[model samples]
Target: MKFRFAMVCSSNQNRSMEAHFLLKRQGFDVSSYGTGTHVKLPGPSIREPNVYDFGTPYKQMFDELRRKDPELYKRNGILPMLKRNLSVKLAPQRWQDNAGDGSFDVVFTFEEKVFDMVIEDLHNRYQVLMKTVLVINLEVKDNHEEAAVGAKLTLDLCQKIEAAESWEESIDDIIVGFEKQHRRKLMYSISFY
Candidate 1:
């Protein structure tokens, strides 16, 4: 089976959306989803009850991207993965089970809160498998930096994974790298803050 990577971004609109497209562009099978449950069409989310409403212009941006970067998708091939299938459902109960489903070889959480929550749940339910999930705090200044950050992170991860002797060994190295970088960034942020 083709390797799968799931990226959970804070808001489904900008950062996560860009990450999804860029990964596909890079020839990796990736899927992205938002944190909150409620999804809307056309423009950002309205102030509807129980909705996260990230205000992502999914349709507009996607169309433009496809037109401008048609080769990015065409070269990759037809049906270049689907956003719907990769979109993860964030729920309390499914948290544990979802982490261990073996569907994803690697999982990344963009925000701190989601990282902490998902990491804890993954550890509790899948003690042995928890190491597979890498908690990355891509805490850049804003969404503008997300694309650059995501690309850099993906490159770093691919390097480590490629260097490893085996998939299992690479998985451990990737997680360690992610944690080390995350802590360093946190320290830098604390000093700046």
Candidate 2:
């Protein structure tokens, strides 16, 4: 049985979308989400951030950003990121808004804050299903280059998890081996829906 997977990040524009595109291409039952109040993109200055609601269409954001400052947006990679996101999903989804999708067997978060949000969201939801999900945090820097590297790492971890005869039974060994091979500490927690 293949595990249902979710990739989560603060805004879900870069890191999560990067992994989502790769995982979907590989035919994994995967989805991506954001844990932020609004999807945010870099603007002209540090104080100014382009923010959109969760359900805002990626195409709309792309067009708006292109209009706002085509050269700046394109140079910063926001335009390209939005284009990739549009190809993957029509709009950005908020993790808090989709708590009912607690059906995922594994949830990968790109940062510690997003991991905490996922864990907290689960705690707030009713545990009617009592389904156990492994929430793993593999910190990935949020940028075009880092996102690509993170997506590849995410795929590698997913492949390792999927290869186990019974992931639940061999989870410990799988995690240990992955950490050793990758030489990175993976933060994880077992939670119920």
lDDT of each: 0.47, 0.91
Off by over 4 Å in 1: 39-57, 60-100, 121-135, 167-193
Worst 10 residues of 2 by lDDT: 94-103
Q: Local error of candidate 1 at 122, Å?
A: 3.2
Candidate 2, residues 1-193, lDDT tens digits: the string is: 7989999999747999999999999999999999999998999998999989999999999999899999999999999899998989899998888746567999999999889989998988889889899999999988899999889989999998899888788888988998898887899899998
Using lDDT as the measure, which candidate wins?
2
How do all models score by TM-score?
0.51, 0.97
True-vs-predicted CA distance for residue 92, candidate 2, Å: 0.1
Local error of candidate 1 at residue 88 (angstroms)? 15
Per-residue lDDT, model 2, residue 176, is 93
What's the residue-level lDDT of 185 in candidate 2?
84
RMSD, one per candidate, in order: 9.9, 1.0
Return the clash pairs for model 2, or none: 127-193
